[model samples]
Target: MIWQGRSRRKPTGGLYRPHRKKRKYEMGRPQTETLIGERKIKLERVRGGNYKVKLVRDKYANVYVPSEGKVVRVEIKRVVENPAHVHYARRNVITKGAIIETEIGLARVTNRPSQEGLINAVLIEQK
Candidate 1:
């Protein structure tokens, strides 16, 4: 389990004794790594009785073409660039701001696939 609580050490390099135990409200969850593959989705529960849609794996993306002013669904050919991590592109991990190759052309992902359930990208190059 991840703790989102206060630090154990002070800024002056002094140890801070815990006054109380951990609480459920100060908790964190693991990260979801969305990958390129067959369509797969997972629903997760969040704080305040809410639900979040997570895209576990996917092969297609909704690409918005500025020239046409419309969105099109196209097959994701591969991950080209990922600013989050260099290895993410090589492993085909889809993330926001990632440049991906699509059937229509190259696109830059605009939405968070892990949190949005679907990939949305803006067209950067036309084929």
Candidate 2:
């Protein structure tokens, strides 16, 4: 688990003792890598007594084309670019703000595919 709290050191270089142990509220989960493949989802129990569906693998995306002024469900052809990381672009890991090539055209992802279980993209320039 990742630590979600601040360090015990002060900005002036003074050490501060812990007042309490690490709580579950200060824990974080690892990042999910949404890959290109058949749809796969994982149910995760989040805080506040709720559940979140994480997409492990997804093959489709809902692409919104401004030229047509409509949203279309299209199959993702491949990852075009990922400004988040060069490795992600090479490995075809779909994250938010990634540019993906769909059946309709090139689109920029607007949502976190791994956490949202669905890919939403807005059409950019055509290839």
Candidate 3:
């Protein structure tokens, strides 16, 4: 498992001795690469008594249109551009700041779908 704790190195490039062993709470999981497909989600129990809804795959998005002043549910056609990674666009991995092709038009993802379990985007250019 990946560790989410602080690094062992200091800002001055000095190595620091271990103060204590790693705890389970400090562990991390793999990244959720959300893709366009049939809806799929995972429920994860996080710290505190809460749960995290991880989105694995989805095909629709709630696109907000400024001209209409309302949100509309639209089908995602494909990934256009992903600022997070160059290959993400080709792989169709959805992430925040990614431009996607939807039934309404081109839209920019405004939220982290993998973390929010939903895709929210703002209409950019109309079809």
Candidate 4:
């Protein structure tokens, strides 16, 4: 069909286009991660983005990272690595964790494990 004054061609210009909304998920609201123990950490809201957590506590006091049986309250210790591994450093000396302390307690964690279905390390905290 032909028009009188205006053409039937779609406008190829400046008006803002509205977004389409869809209800696809079977469940309710989206799930989010819950941080236990320390809630001080604030990470980036966007997924896949990197976050760097720094110590805000007094410099005089130190953090304690457990080792073997005893805990090492080194002057300069922080969560240098994510989730499992942590790095502790003082002066120019740096030592990676053979064992580490988590929100629950101390445990020996690694990226990979040996043996089939066999995992190492458990919480060292007392009952």
Candidate 3, lDDT over the whole model? 0.94
Q: What is the TM-score of each candidate against the true structure?
A: 0.88, 0.91, 0.89, 0.19
Question: Which stretches of model 4 miss by more than 4 angstroms?
Answer: 1-97, 110-121
Give the number of the best model, judged by lDDT.
3
Worst 10 residues of 2 by lDDT: 1-10
Rank by lDDT (best first): 3, 1, 2, 4
lDDT of 4 by residue, 48-105 (tens): 5644332112111123334454333222222222332232221111122224344444
- Full-model lDDT, candidate 4: 0.30
lDDT of 2 at 38: 95
lDDT of 3 at 2: 55
lDDT of 1 by residue, 61-81 (tens): 999999889999999989999
User: lDDT of all predictions, in order shown?
Assistant: 0.92, 0.90, 0.94, 0.30
Which should have the higher lDDT, number 1 or number 2? 1
Clashes by residue pair, model 4: none
Worst 10 residues of 3 by lDDT: 1-10
| C-alpha lDDT of residue 29 in model 1 | 71
Q: Could you give candidate 2's per-residue lDDT for residues 24-50 as a string of tens digits?
A: 887778889999999999999999989
Of the pair 2 and 3, which is ahead by lDDT?
3
